[model samples]
Target: MVRIACLILALILPALVAADVADVYDFSDRAQEQRYRNLIAELRCPKCQNQNIADSNAPISKDMRDVVYRMMNDGASNEEIVESLVGRFGEFVRYKPEFDSRTFLLWATPAIAVFGGLLVVAGVVIRSRRSGSESPALSAEEKARVDKMLADQDRPS
Candidate 1:
């Protein structure tokens, strides 16, 4: 009876402790709620680094969510909301950063890498083709000797 009580308590205690209470927000409509969701999903959590604000449980993420909600309530445009956050947190908060002078290299890196790979592949292909074409053909005497050796190998010891 004591063991059963201990087991039930142990299970219940962990479940209670592990369950996180989610933050609740009152939006005027479903569109506003969706916009809130999208904004949070697009914004990265500065404290969490790899996680978006929507997915992060960090204090900073909660604050950011609150700010987004307040801004939306005040009739701020999506661009205005994004700009405000970007101004406050720097461009690092945005999942898709604006293509500006600072971010040009970042956006161009994939293209540059692909072009470089193509050049390397072309060089290898050209080199292989050249080497293959330049190889001297075996002489008639050499072919005859190879055939003789093969015939000898086929014969019984």
Candidate 2:
């Protein structure tokens, strides 16, 4: 029993000792550290859609963190650093991609769809109104036929 317990402990000990090395970010200054954390939080982890690179545990997240840190240490401004990364990875890396020609539809598509739906609804309303106006003056023969049908129904029980 003691030997079995010892084996179990040994097995578990190695697993516990193997730490996740990607969480550590070495920044020389508090400001740079804050900037690095902020940028990483704003940037999406390509491997994990729901998490920012700062909070992700994936290797790709670590690599992205390293890239941001390197750019910061090189004295790049926050905007410049973000631009550099965006340039390398494209708009998909950003939590909010910029609105440009290719992505114009992204921001405007919903509004355009709403406008189109309104136009369709207006067209249907206008068409219905036009049809109602044109048919208001039913032919005398049609009115006589409708009156005979009503008279027959009225004469029944």
**Who wins the lDDT comparison?**
1
How well does each candidate superpose onto the true structure, as a TM-score?
A: 0.72, 0.72
Clashes of each: 0, 0
lDDT (10s digit) by residue, model 2, range 1-157: 9999999999999988896554666778898778777899899877887798888888987888888888788888888978887888778788888888989999998999999999999999999999888856779999999999999999958
In model 2, where do residues sit more than 4 Å from their true spots?
1-9, 26-32, 138-157
The CA lDDT of each predicted structure is 0.94, 0.85
RMSD of each: 6.9, 4.2
List candidate 1 segments past 4 Å from native.
1-21, 135-157
lDDT over C-alpha atoms for residue 102 of model 1: 99
Over 4-98, each residue of candidate 1 has an lDDT whose tens digit, in order, gives: 99999998999999999898999888998999999999999988878999999999999999999999999999999999999999999998999
Model 2 TM-score, 2 decimals: 0.72
